[model samples]
Target chain A: MHGLRRVPENLSGRGDKVMEDKYDVVVVGAGPAGSTAAYSAAKNGARVLMVDRRRELGVPVQCGEAIAEDILNELGIKPDRRWAVNRTNAVKIVSPSGIEIRISEKKVTGKVGYVLNRKVFDKFLAVRAVKAGAEAMIGSYVNGLVFKNGRIGGIRGVGLDGKFEVAADVVIAADGVGSRVARWAGLNTALRFDDIETCAQFQMVGVDFESLSMLEFYLGSRISPGGYAWVFPKGDDLANVGLGVLGSRAERRPIEYLRDFVSRMPGLSKGKIVEVNVGGVPVCGPIEETVGDSLMVVGDAARQVNPLTGGGIDSAMRAGTIAGEVAAKAVEEGDTSKERLKEYERRWKEAMGKRLTRYLKAKEILLGLSDGELDKLAEVLRGVKFDRISLTDMLKVLVKANPKLLWKLRGLL
Target chain B: MEVDSSLCLRCGACVSICPVDAIEATDSYVRPNERCTDCGACRKICPVGAIK
Candidate 1:
């Protein structure tokens, strides 16, 4: 009676005791995307509710925890010392032939990055949403959607309280890869095995020499098939060593590749393993649809990720912010129709569309290259200075340096 | 790629990966349309191994 609001306890119509299950906006999945959307929506005066099935927020980190500095700035997330584990400036791209090419962070845009303590960074985002008047509940499993007049109306699931359905003016699905929520809502959110990178990472301590000042990448089909291996130092001799393999090309598990990868790296081989993380990252181009009726899907659910690099945190945040703003405005206009939610798709496309399209084209070409071709690619990129090292930029450089080797890829350009 | 239909969670991973937009998913089944080139990209990502 103290903290509970009364409504229908159940549709069975027993006694009058019930809980209020209504909000202006409901966001499923309390990761970066969900929290950002909740924050944006609440900031714009939409009473928001965020839910996640995780018993604790940000635990069991699933990513490499690397974020470009500009991505953080794009989302207006300030550089906070607390969540940032390492301020990385140097980066090296190693070829199949053991050729190492150092790329300056300032020269290659987005190369200037940080290795985050995601356990803290993710929670910080959810806290920001709560501070903005958005309420969040963990341990809530949203099993299905509530449809009204063929439009998304709310969510139904078992939570700490029990099985219940909550109503909302809009439902924002920010669930990550393998999003059943998106599927249940009649949306296509699947990644072809070829378009997905099954990644595994290990946090290892006692890493040998060299400053935690650089992020490194190793490329070769032998090492990771269609994906690559990385070493992201978290400072204090603790580093995340990981490898991702194209799901289709993976003969064994991605973890096997990571284990083999770790043993090869002198800095990682002997280090003591502390934490291991495994997950599926979608690398497909943007989905054909992102919104329908009163529903707006943001982040990975919409495939708002870089097709070339398996990174989505920044894109997720950006999409979430836009979804929140658009949802709030739609609510104020009393239009939660499909047409109204289309504005969210429009804004995010304007912001991140071109880059993603270019990346997708580039990814197709990269997948077609062999390890020997990759070595040649490394050779051509040695002396090049990258003001902004994007897939488009890389493709241009490759075509220019090795005209014959990559002439077939010119059509994409 | 063959659509088992039974194992298909209808997640659409295959439908989205069709290079030629060959696959479509209904509430019950996922199948390749006339446009299918049989590139097999969709079968690779099916979580349930519904497609082969």
Candidate 2:
């Protein structure tokens, strides 16, 4: 029989050097990846510390704020008061020639995604992480990594008052697109300018609109060369109008393109701009390696954004959950080595990786096509009913529209 | 206003979207004036969430 664990006499002692707190895990960047990692880790009975560089967890909102409802349910997170904007039921894709193809709302998983209030939604996720027993830190800028025997130990960051270090068995890198943590840890995540897309968006009010229920997407080189524009309805006569342009074409600039498009639209021209936002989306392939020696990366930091849509939230959450389980297991086994952490890459690749690879390939092929070719393709597609269109059906249409392009797509298709 | 040079793409997105012409593209950055309405247009238009 084991005696009751003796209580240390230093419950309130002055000689005590305040034993440095050590968490099971330390998550950097309190975005979707970090927050999800923290929540999951804490739920597994591991201590977690979540940090964000901003003074506030989420504000000065960014992101399209669109996430699939199926993903939300899978993560066990419900739509709360804070981030709920509206449930999206349908999507309209307008071709360069102004031909529109509407995809109706058919809930395959009995779920429809919501257009969120990002700042609020982000904070809500952070709050959930905290509720799950993770310590939350804001306005904390991570200065560098802590290492032990050539393996990652934890992180060091500066808060409002003083600098401090958090020690943990594992570190989760969720720092967004420009994150350097993984690179610093010797995980290569180099990205090229062409792989990036510079995007701009605005929250506008007082605009007269029809059918507030649908999300409209405009595609064509004329509107946005190597990119497209979107108008996401935010209710109350408000909308988030945005554009994403290839970063290589930095000369045109996203806002300039947005301005030119908005000026031409009578429905949008009347709206008064209440907010402006800008960000860059990585429209390239995923990072080659997502884990190494007690470390894992998720979300935009890992270059996991959709190559075509530039949407990352849902994927990030999924990746984060996977990262959490792997990191926690690594900690429990006392082996945070690269071999053990390789599970993260294996898990994500097996699950979402295949789909992402397919989409990335499609994006590359589509980007190589000429404006005339795209217009012709769009014209052909306008005749087909979207209800009957599957991936193969769409490919058939493309093949019929341009037989010459078929040979080039042999490898990709 | 000071643009953190690290994140500024200097793509002139702000200058292009400025309805009041309060922002201009300088050699290194987008310079804003007292005329800046803080309408948050530049903030929304930035692709990297660079503007506040």
Candidate 3:
């Protein structure tokens, strides 16, 4: 029910038919969040345009690529063989003293998850958005925002053809961790050193796995230093090996730690590295303000990543859906003010805000524990198996065995 | 602040943590702009020791 407002004819000289100068909504970044937002907006009867700086979608994959099946189900999407490369059913957690805790559906609350081929998966989502009547412009870089009467009006950027400006009623920023879009619009999305996780990853072939369907996590100060290392399997002999180091505690670059870890591990040292990815993850939880007049920020741009797990694909998609729906409704009602856009913040908070805050608190406490404490905690639960244990129950068990942890963990209880 | 181009990955890790918006990155290169106050936030967060 929203109508597209046309810009002055002189604003754009080219008048390209495929690339319009105006749209109901313009989404920057064609990843899961942007594509999902475009798709939802278009489905809700809004004319949409999605853009990405990359010439190809998902190239140079930046993620570990593991996502829970429940997320896909909630989005009403079925896993396809083309992008879902492998399925994992369990997680192996390794402590500093070589203690292993295997958690699966039988032992704890775990579910089937997928390891994605992001290069294919990102393009697939973009294609779905296009099919839903959203126009996509790849190989484009958005460097600035267009403001009209002191409010966000549109985006200004360069595409494969040339420089262009597109006017829109609302702009969705899904530009990932280093996003400057929202900041450019006057939102303080800057992160502190202690609030981020510096990370590095290597996709290797001929790797060894303890279990083909299990994900491995190595935790210890010597291993990662206030963070952890992970191995997510892609095939029987292929895996994505990675590590994240807390920015405040990192003594060396994350890549150096990862290389040392791989060299020391017999199972990983034998593999050959095929690809390298280095990036940063914001572990600060969601920003305070994610909505402004005619602007909405979602995904990593809004710091929607899980502080404890460093997982974001699920939250990004969920937040994108809500942002898109809210943007469409605001446009339809002809009120794209900050007051109207506040609905998006309210809805996402109602869904996952409290959980993210709790995780942030847990991450702080866990990161404060020394290697000796972690070892003691792991030793206490060495052989204990639970049919099903809630996070509180697990915390209670640890607190009972090691009363030393009671003061630090009492907040969680 | 200086970016060791050889070690830099153009991943924009430094760009986000720069409080003054002093870093700029493209597909081919990353550089510190005039706004840089030598805070070292970028250097600390660089995954490959690219920033100095």
The 10-residue segment of model 2 chain A with minimum total lDDT is: A1-10
Model 1 TM-score?
Answer: 0.84
Better of 1 and 3 by lDDT: 3
Error of 1 at A106 (Å): 3.2
> lDDT (0-100) at residue A79 of candidate 1?
77
Best by DockQ: 3
* Winner on DockQ (2 vs 3): 3
lDDT tens readout by residue for model 2, A281-397: 777868878988788999988888888788888888899888888888788888888889898899988878877887787788878877776677777777776543244557777
Query: Model-by-model lDDT, in order?
Result: 0.77, 0.73, 0.85
Off by over 4 Å in 1: A1-19, A107-111, A385-393, A411-413, B1-52
lDDT score of residue A121 within candidate 1: 93
Query: Which segments of model 3 are wrong by more than 4 Å?
Result: A1-17, A107-110, A387-390, B1-6
TM-score, one value per model? 0.84, 0.83, 0.93
Candidates 1 and 3, the one with greater DockQ: 3
Root-mean-square deviation of Cα positions for candidate 2 versus the true structure, in angstroms: 8.3
Off by over 4 Å in 2: A1-20, A107-111, A388-393, A400-405, A408-413, B1-52
Model 1, C-alpha of A137: deviation from truth (Å): 1.2
